[model samples]
Target: MVIHQNFLPLASSGLPVGKIYLGYLFIRPVHNPETPFKMDVSFIKHWKKRTTLEVGHRGMGNSYTKCAVARENSIHSLNKASERGADYVEFDVQLTKDKIPVIFHDFHVMVSVAKRSPEKDVHQIAVKDLKLDQLRLLHLDHVQHHSNTPLNEQVIKVTGENDEAEDLRPFPTLIEALQNVSTDVGFNVEIKFPMVQEDGINECENYFEHNEFLDRILKDVFLHGGKRRIVFSSFDPDICTMVATKQNKYPVLFLCCGANTRHQVYQDERTRTSLTAVNFAAGCGILGVNFHSEDVLRDHSPITKAKQLGLISFVWGDELNDKTNVEFMKKTVGVDGVIYDRIGETELRSSVFMLEKAKKNELFSKKIPSPVQTPRAGSVHFLNDQPKIPGLNLSQSVNQPHHEWPISSSSRRRSPTVTTEAEKYFAASHGLIQLNQGYLPQQLTTAREV
Candidate 1:
């Protein structure tokens, strides 16, 4: 048996506060105690058999050409994704002219003006040319014409004509996003690197150095990311190499747009084929490759080759908007995970699929191992004194001093009879004062009065 312990601080609640000791034990079953187990040879395909994680694309979903309530890449949309129960939230991160990293998807945004002049008010402006302050003052007109869609149909009215730039939804800084988002959910941060044009010309005249760009994001992640898991991905191979070489904190994934993708076709070696992408990722010691869904649908050979090379595989594209293709990728194609625009809908569908399979297995009396909650016995004492709560596997319990006990689990389980008494004892011992709501010890919060 293997056990892991997490230490967590108690949240603010109605009950009185004192010294709290909590331990969260995760118990795993082992086949053999002495022998070393063989590694999983199937690579990421094994994850497909288990639960398929739902990743929110641009927080819930982004529709630049269509009307949307909460603006894409806003803090509100990020919170909405968390509320909808997304396993991971993916967002684009780019650098401004002033060297500030912000969360935005498009390379440029259209600014609306009250009066039209010869300056071509509808011209698309690059995000890198303007500072954060200048970008904030402009009105965003998120509209783009699709091949099959009409020009007028692409207009999405996001804000009022006279609204100030600050009043509109401004891009969120990297620090703000890292600090404000939920701690439980993971983040898939895509580092935006402009590509060379198909005619072998640079798209942007000036940009940040490769090392400087990668370091800026790394600084924010190390300082504010806390314990949240982060996976770094980018279309530029140089960015992947830099991330892998610079830091070992997070895993790096190479995002590819193969030959069949509708995305801008490039003459570069890496983006032209899926095979090259897998080879490049494996050579650079990258964790995986996020292939365009169209490429995977055309040929699953790249996925199989990646598995053989011990690399993870993921798929994303507009083709995944269809429900049938999502199922096909999960069940037939056997990818590790799929990124979709609609997070809640995909999560619900996957749950239903699992439920149906479980029902079929139940008819044959197949045994399934499900996680059973251990009773609430969360105080710290010496080894001789065990917790009074029943149903605890003391024999398998590994002794650890600091462990995080979930407040949610504590609420569900039976309460400790000594909870109030313990609080009072600690409060008296520490000379704590009764605050507005409850008795708070000086060590808890930094507030002056409470």
Candidate 2:
């Protein structure tokens, strides 16, 4: 649990040990009543039921590389993902020069400026340097690389200067997304913060102060995120810590590149590997770790370690685009969620939470017969004539007739009745069930007991 002294300067400061001081402003940890020490696992309760969530990456897909329906992080992209039945939609959020939280991915954006020649001169500008109005007035392109790398062939043209539709435009405000997107779909809000790369280059020079930066974003979310299932994540461990301390309504996940060969690793020690990220997350008392697909594909033991620690495991990266890899993570590797591009393109799937809700409603609507009491001593009773409900796991009594519940093929493949320690922890914490106790037949009869 050692924090680098350089990351947090506390020398000669009169503030508390965990409190961070930036100039004259003191940042103190705020306790959330909902989740005092850990994140509220109720958001992803279905994960324990073997329902691996499908989160749309940057909405429908990353527009720069993938063939997405709309610009990445745009309002249209998020709404499309919701319509496609994605359980959750992940998007990057950073602050504009005006301190407005806006959805965008890269730290730098390529702004097309008019020149004397026919072709417009493109300039790479840091997103934080531009005001919201100024950013909305520029034709922006995704910056792939600084060393003359060609722009992506599939890049969605973001014409913020023209009279384009609001939904199709890039840099949609955070408040706008909270209001317009479907409430059924959860949000995996990745807080965008600049960091040092493995090559000793800073992602963005002279970015906003961490404390002030997080404050503004948290303010927006707190004010606008009404009853929405939200989870905050960040590659910067400090940002994750700040977010976890700032609010209790939503959970915080540490985003780790892990052991990836596709991109240069970050300089942060906490993000060097999935194992280290897990240790950091466990030590920080956060919810879980979002490991890159490369690391998990290389060695899935980290996910096992995460599960053992009762932490939620989520995988993200370009490797998730392959259907086989997605299946491997979902079935073989056993991750809680997968963040990928073009969700529902390979095979259409509904949100696991939504499906579970429907199943609960259907199960409760029918009258479940109570177990018949037997007058004979030392003998088990059987409900041989009771009709079994689909997708419901009925308790089996000794010497009773074995009845198999009819379940769809897809349901059997995706979800199993087997429970995990993480699920037990959630069920106990949320008062859904008593720890180390099996569900009785009567418990299944009520929605609250279940």
Best by TM-score: 2
lDDT (tens digit, per residue) of candidate 2 on 253-275: 89999878877787777788899
For model 1, residues 1-450, the per-residue Cα lDDT tens digits are 333332222222211112233422111222222222433331212222345556677776775743334566766667667667676778899888888888888776665545455433455567887688777666666557334654334445544345433313657888888888876567889999776746665545566666566677777776788767678899877667667655555678899998773677655577678898999889767888998989888988998999899888878887877778878888887777777776675354333333555787787797668896444333222211334444443232324332222123333332122235544554454445555444433444656645
> Quick one: best lDDT, which candidate?
2
What is each predicted model's overall lDDT from 0 to 1? 0.64, 0.75
Worst 10 residues of 2 by lDDT: 377-386
Query: What is the Å distance of residue 417 in model 2 from its true position?
Result: 67
| Cα error of candidate 2 at position 300, Å | 0.8
True-vs-predicted CA distance for residue 77, candidate 2, Å: 1.0
